[model samples]
Target chain A: MTMRSVGDGKAEFYELLPGREHVTVIEPRANPFRLDLRELWNYRDLVLLLVRRDFVAQYKQTILGPAWHIIQPLLTTLMFTIVFGKIARLPTDGLPPFLFYMAGTVIWTYFANVFTATTGTFAHNAHIFGKVYFPRLVMPLATLVSRLIAFAIQFAVFLGILAYFAVTDAAVQPNLWVLLTPVLLMMMAAIGLGGGLIVAAFTTRYRDLVVLVSFGVQLLMFATPIIYPLSSLPARWQFWASLNPIAPVVEAFRYAYLGQGTLSVGMLLLSALVVVLILSAGVVLFNTAERTFVDTV
Target chain B: MPRPVIRIENLSKYYRLGAIGSHTLREDVNRWAARLRGRPDPMPRTGAAEPETREGGGIWALKNLDLEVGAGEILGIIGPNGAGKSTLLKVLSRITAPTEGRVTMRGRVGSLLEVGTGFHPELTGRENIYLNGAILGMKTREVDRKLEAIVAFAETSQVLDTPVKRYSSGMTLRLAFAVAAHLEPEILIFDEVLAVGDRAFQDKCLDKIQDLARSGRTVLFVTHNMGPALDLCSRGIVLAAGQCAYDGTMNDAVRHYQGCAVGGRRQTR
Candidate 1:
């Protein structure tokens, strides 16, 4: 069958059977492939409302409120500077340890928060999923967008720090490569969302996997360049480390903003390739899971 | 003549039962391993044969039922508890899939299984109006255009901007049914949702359903209330023991329904 919108006074199209028999050349519309994008578009205000709700609910009624946005990363940067920069004497390529870790923390926070929030999507919203039938993907996408607000708040703080250091002759300067920040942000979001979707799909069948995902995501922070730069790892371990996907994102951020680390163009391209594969697999699995998840969840 | 809006053929669904925790893992693995050895696996232990479909039974809720709902037809399905009315509507709404058969449906399917399916409690009523409308397959502009009417219909104009969490259950139900009424989907499925609202609101909901019927939409209703069933449906089906016991005029179905409730039951076909 063919269906069309009634946007104009002209006839909308809907063909079935004999008159359309020769239309086998066209692709068959499947379960949600025939999804009405117009319907989702119409719900844009709802999407905005969800995004706003997520942003506020995270910090609302808290003692510290949204100030935790800056404080969390500041504390994280201090801890990293103590452990990796002091105890391990990790090289930051002569950049101050605080400056080095803060960049990575702000960028890493975006990915980590998005991943953790999205991974529990089905389990967290079991009540909503069972009742409603909007585009299921909208939940995760709205979460990712909401998290960008937190990232933006932290980034402004990072810029303030950068400005303070530059004026005080603390050896900070905005580099030309900083223009690559948006690309790095996109890569981080893609990997986080793609990985989170895979976890969400698996968690619906095996509930234990949800706990593992939370634990694994935390463990992954140390595996990535969160606490230290990629330079600290040995040459043999570097190749394997770059394969972690988030490693390239962190490395790229450090290279662009801090100007004290190496960013391998080839490795970043490889990370993009891996993200594309992961996201494609995620979409297929998420689509298949949504069919029976209502029953299983 | 309009084509059939919703069609189902020989639809069946099955579910497996097992222990809930890690202790069952060993048995599940043993079952698989025994199957690979080309031998009959162990069967359920004594009393493990409880049917899964009947709220806690292990039998089919619906067995090989064929149904076709024409465009603009208001079909009311009446059945005893466990007669598979809700299960059938769930399948039609694409909330779940049938195990052994297929359903071919044209146009969108909107189901109001309960109030506030996708409503976020922290969001205002205005926000949920759009969110629920989108879930029901209405476009954004359609919701925007009808927003005033929806709030007005529920008499909730004053509370539109208030968080839904603060609304009473009756107020929530009123707003929810109002959104459903305004959705105007090609096929609308209602599963005892009308039973929740107050008497006055139920009348309003019933009147809206009657209006929708006149608007050339197909509606599938499951209810025990015979008056509204007969008022809204052109035809009805009475289900007993997972099969259709009677399918004919609304009055006949109601009569069969009444007889089953009062007299010692007749043998179900």
Candidate 2:
């Protein structure tokens, strides 16, 4: 029998037969927590292609195509202006309600898209996932990247509105804190991926959870400080709302540009800590689920 | 002999077919406990289709399977329906996890389990070449290098920019096979993908598969087309009820399968 190592070294050399060395061992997942970074890195091009496919799938064969991205937020902001601004008499802290709601919508849309898209990672992609082998995480990671295209489009529109308000009334003051844009986006991505993976891991078995997700996202929107200013809430409610993790994210995003909402270093730090914990936990569950999700799904 | 590229030992994959209903919180707790104790699945039964052979309320798709293949061997796996052929391929491709045992391979493996996987009918043929190529484990630069070749080979140069939905099924398969042909994995597995195209396209695919095998790559394929299967493979495996019924030359394996079909379950017993 001949025994020799291939390449620099055999990471896992199995000699099941004489003179035969096996490099990859496929067995039941023993340790799913270890990040399979090498496998994921090799398939990085697949992730990019998947993202490109998403952009094409969105626009292909549709008459409106990219127009929908622009129109979606514009229409939603218009409704919020009418409903919350006029009918409900929600205070925008002296800033124009149109600009205020658009800001919230812009940030919220990115978060919601990332959250909802990753939530269906298992069930929606079961067909392809069952047939081929790529890092299953590639699907969700692509969603995180592809949704950025829509978010960028809407972000430009938000900046346009901010420029108008900054020049016209000076009520919406643009501060150096606006530099927090990328950081705020990262925070949302973390929570979205973390929360979505947790829910996706369970939704495979329960499935009823899948039904409640969209509705739950709406409830979460209400729970956050989206429709109302944190100052408008009662003191006790405001304290609870500040701990929402996303509350400070939304607050910081608005305060960075408008310079009027409540912003706190302690609260922001606490929220960041919570988001990190949720994301770490999400990664563990998501990794575990992807191993054998096909059999169950 | 060529060095072995794949080795499997004591491989088993059990499925809970009808017991998806017992998926309540209590069952979840039971399964978790069993796993905690390093025990086999607590569920019973071993088949979804063979209701007559229900073991312990679970279905063992591939039970205690042991297989190995040397580099450059063209293995043809011929089996009856539900004989766990696809399950074996899926396990080898790492598409799903095994319930028991281990499978080891020395080289990068690619599976053509289906043509045009992740193909959006909305996307044009030119764009889909990149998407399909990536899914099949090709790099972006690799696809770029072979773009014109793929287009010309598939005879899809005229409709390269047209959405795949507009193409006839034959054109779609040709384009898909073109991408599949260009994939350069060390180990390639196929599942009935070649028999779908027309005679001309099928011959073209057979030639490509032959070329792949000739170039020191191990190719394992599952097919029901006996004539082509026998012609393409010298060594064949006949699977019956998730077990290897016969392993030998393609001629003998087909004869064994045909004989078993006429003899029924009594022969295996």
Who wins the DockQ comparison?
2
- Lowest lDDT 10-residue stretch of candidate 2 chain A: A1-10
- Which regions of candidate 1 fall more than 4 Å away from where they truly are? A1-46, A59-64, A86-89, A167-173, B19-58, B227-229, B261-269
Distance from true location, Cα of B133 in model 2, Å:
0.5
lDDT of 2 at A128: 95
TM-scores for chain A over all candidates:
0.86, 0.92
Candidate 2 reaches a DockQ of: 0.48
Q: What are the per-model DockQ values?
A: 0.31, 0.48
* TM-score leader: 2
lDDT of 1 by residue, A1-297 (tens): 123332322122223433321110011123443444554565666667678667655665589988988899999999989998999888776778888889888998899888888788888877776666666777888888888989999999998887776676554656888888888888889888888888888777677776687688779988997777788789999899999988988887877776667689999999999998887777667766776576666
Question: How well is each residue in A170-251 modelled by candidate 2, as lDDT tens digits?
Answer: 7889798888889889999989999999999988777777888999999999998888888889899889999999999999
TM-score of chain B in each prediction: 0.84, 0.86
User: In candidate 2, what are the lDDT values of residues B148-189, reduced to their tens digit?
Assistant: 889888999999989999999989999998998888777999
lDDT of 2 at B82: 91
Against the true structure, what is each candidate's TM-score? 0.86, 0.90
